[model samples]
Target: MLRLESVYLRLKNGSEEVPILENINLDLEDNKFYALTGPNGGGKTSLAKVIMGIYKNDEGRIYLDGKDITDFSITERAKAGISYAFQNPPRFKGLKIKDLLKISADENSLRAILRSVGLCPQDYLDRECDSGLSGGEMKRIELASVLARPSRLVIYDEPEAGVDLWSFENLLQLIRNYHKRGNVTSVVITHHERVLSLADEIILLVDGKIADRGSRDKILPLIQEDARCCWKANCGGNNDEVECY
Candidate 1:
């Protein structure tokens, strides 16, 4: 389990301090799937970074399983059972896919983990993580690497980013199946409806604060309402990108 108390994070903007996260008090139970969704610039990724220790709070404490980890560095947090997958994962030109899985998996399990992410071990296990791979491929490989490694809390900042429509479904199923196994907590920062609908709870962040959080039935409608409002104000008669989140 993880808990954040009175968390406040602000970044410097010229001579002034701009608030990134304000009074973010949150509690996430173990073995549950949480979807963090909201409009752009609402501080969703910032909050996740704060939890992952990439960003330190101006005031507050971060606790994982009752231990205060506010002062923990990002590397310490990862060693403490927290894994974060970036929105745009970096390409390690010489690192093969299996090299990542070797952190905690054996040869046999490495194949299984690749298969779980819809990649053929024989085809991709030896392939380098370079510019040749598509965005979706790199995302899946990054996701699988994190999942294969033992971690109590996994924070994925926009797993759907740069993914094609076909790959998005697979990514959703990957998260769903992993959550079903229990024992590990999954927090996915996404704006996609299908991803939000799969969560045990939907957390809405607005203006750097917790606006609302509840079941899909309760929160999905509110998000849809925001889409409609966004359509009226910003869509410019084009229904393609709603800018809802």
Candidate 2:
């Protein structure tokens, strides 16, 4: 459903140019769930932004349903049936949840959107999106926005970040249900093992490139094996480990 051909992104800092993505070539089929996991600074999020048109590519092309969209604006991409949820959601001061929902799904459809996110319509509709809400609440609000848009391609950048255990599980179920509904392609960027297990394919990004990409059997074992060495007290692995999966 989506294709990225020889995509490249570079940031210009005075005379220096830092390449964030180098020659990225990927094809995403319709109605599939793709999970991208990698160490920090591996360009996973950068590639997501590139797909969403939040960052312009310095080389190559991006095509949505066979049409070149490499130079499309973010708003244009959204209009073209693409939705994105950021790692750190933005707070719109003085904006009530109902207003945002009405804007995305139309005033007549707000209740349905809230229900999709497991939220009570009446209780949340009048609430302002601000510091008063908990992290998990904000995450759910962002998710509701995505559901309201009903895009063909939804790129969630670490949807599990702020969510509590119960909410995280709920999010997983919601995503699974969305996938089963058909015609929607999802690209989830997460490092959680449980989340990765839900993917049809796990793409491991390393140093701005795809180092490993395959089914769970092909990739999970490698990470698990490597974790044997680098696991620490906080991450639940031994500190003296070497070549950990």
Candidate 3:
């Protein structure tokens, strides 16, 4: 289980302090799937970063399965069974795909991990995880690396980004399978309705705070209603100015 108590975060904009997350309190249960969704720039990703230890909270405590990890570094958090997949996965200039997988897990299991993400080890194992790889390829490789590790909490920031339709569908199924195994707690930050529908619970964040949270059956209809309003004619004053809910 993961718990956040009265968490707050602020950012420095020039000389002024701007609040990014405000009074966040949450308890994420083990072996559950959560979808965190809201409009862009709503601090959804910032909250994930704080949980992953990429960013520190200015106030309050974070506990993972009874241990206080509020002051833990990113490396410490990873060792504590927290894994995060970035929105834009970094490209390693000198690292081979197989080498990264090997570092993530044993060499004997590398091929299976690659194949799980729809990559052929014989073709990609020798290639460097550099600019030569497509965005979707890099994303899959990053996800595969995460899968190689044993994690109690897995957070994926926009996993569907930069992938083709077919790849996106496959990725969704992969995630579903992983979640069904009940080995880790999953948090997916996504705006897609398909992804949102898969969650056991949906958290709606707005203006740096949780606006609402409930089971998918309870929250999805509200989101769908909002989307429907935005798609109607003259919803945004004119068709040329259509707004996404």
My TM-score estimates for the predictions, one after another, are 0.86, 0.87, 0.90
User: What is the total number of backbone clashes in candidate 3?
Assistant: 0
Candidate No. with top TM-score? 3
Candidate 3, 1-245: lDDT as tens digits: 99999999999989999999999999999899999998778898899999999889999999999999999999999999999988889899999999888877888998899998999989999999999999999999999998788789999999999888888998888877877877799999999889998899999987799989999999999888876765433443676766455
All candidates' lDDT scores?
Answer: 0.88, 0.84, 0.90
Arranged by TM-score with the best first, the candidates are 3, 2, 1
Model 3 C-alpha lDDT versus the unseen true structure: 0.90
Q: Tens digit of lDDT per residue, candidate 2, span 134-207? A: 77788888988887667889988898987888768988888778778888999899989998998998888876
Q: Is candidate 2 or candidate 3 better by lDDT?
A: 3
Model 1 scores a C-alpha lDDT of 0.88
Clashing residue pairs in candidate 3, if any? none
Q: Which ten residues in a row have the lowest lDDT in candidate 3?
A: 229-238
Residue 66 of model 3 has an lDDT of: 94
